[model samples]
Target: MATERMAFDDLPPAVLAGVESHAGEIVKAEMVSQGFNSEIAARVFTANGAFFVKGLRADHKRVWTQRREAEVNPFLRGIAPALRWQTEDAGWVLLGFEALNGHHADYSPGSPDLPKVADVLSRLGEVGCPDIELRHMEQRLERYAAKPSDLAHFAGNSLVHTDLNNENVMVDGPAYLVDWAWASRGAAWLDAAYWVVWLMAAGGHDPQSAERWAGRIPAWQTAAPEAVTAFALATVNVWEEIAGEDPDPWTAGIRDASRRWAEHRKAA
Candidate 1:
């Protein structure tokens, strides 16, 4: 179950004022019940237009994430909603974006959204890594690498949205990626690899089927098979450690799914 969402009316006065300034006189502020990253995730309405505002307390441990999203937004064109305004005031950090009227993409098997998701991945794979300081994909996966040199396969210039969970995708006509706090610079097929583990966890496909779905993305097709296998195994280790620290059905499910993928890779 999701935690309670923060409503526009419930915002602290200073935060509310800042949000209104970036948006307009609030007509309605409907909280989005999905997604867990932001303390506030809502569509702020005004006579002028609706803008999505998501934020957290300035003192929050993840406050730096606000900067990451703001930094990456300009280079994300089409892949993410446009950032309109950002404010830091009254112990809070807030960002306003073009409100999107879309629901999360269904990665479940046979969902028509799969094609669009694949298309977005292929398109994003083509974008050169932005000239910014970001965590390198290889470094991020080092703990899970079977061999130190296996990390080398992950080096590339493509910008990657490291988390491709279903909640991070919104689709109206085209899919829009969101919650970019974990964005990184990595191999072109990196995001596709992330998506495969989630697809398996969602019961959308077996490992073979999931890889086939990912293959629709050009980068995934060309990625070295050994690297793909290493990633699958690395995901198993990553999720296993996460579940051990905070065991929950969601984390456990991903760990299990990743294990299945790793087993399939071994047999292949």
Candidate 2:
């Protein structure tokens, strides 16, 4: 379930004071409209500098996501914004991150951001999975796979940012992946596969074109033909379930794109 967003002024006094203690008095705050997970998502200006702050009550069902983000931050150096500080006070867990000055990545066909994003994914494939609690890809996709044995293809030690929504990618001169909430230990090629669907859905790329882009990452090329087909079929089931649960345009688009990709993979 999505949390109702709150503005800075609505925060408890203790939480505000904690933020102030670390970053100085909050001179102004601009709530970010993107993303659905955080209850408090804003760019806060303080005497020290501007920082992006997001928080959820300590006892919230999804509070574990906060810890996951914090735990994974250290391993995402250069790929994501640095986590400057974290605080748990007034029944809330808050994370302050270095504010980034960039726009959401443009995934449309012919956009220059495509190459930049592919480059970042290539670099990310090199980062070893840190020794921390993380969801494993095989387990996550097990129920959706055609057969239990197919799950084996999704297992690996590479750290992957599974959610490749264009909005989660920030682009300036270089592309940066954000939202570590769904970081997982998965095959190095899986992230590239995930991006292929987003490319078709958001970039208007056909499956052939999208696969061409995925081919840019060496890890992607390492994926076995059967493994890629299994992933595509499993993704169709995953997106259909998501769209069924949340009937929204975005979910529907992705569901349709997943179907298209699955069909393409089957024909090949």
> Which candidate achieves the best TM-score against the true structure?
2
**Candidate no. 2 TM-score:** 0.98
Full-model lDDT for every candidate = 0.87, 0.92
Question: Candidate 2, clashing residue pairs?
Answer: none
Per-candidate TM-scores read 0.95, 0.98
lDDT (tens digit, per residue) of candidate 1 on 1-268: 2334566577788877877787777788888877777888988888669998888878888878788999989998998999999998788889999989888989899998899999888889988888887899899999998889889988888999988899899997999998898889899999999999989998859998999999999999778889899888888888888888667888888889999999999889
Which tens-of-lDDT digit does each residue in 90-123 have in candidate 2? 9999999999998999989899999999999999
- Misplaced by over 4 Å in model 2 are none
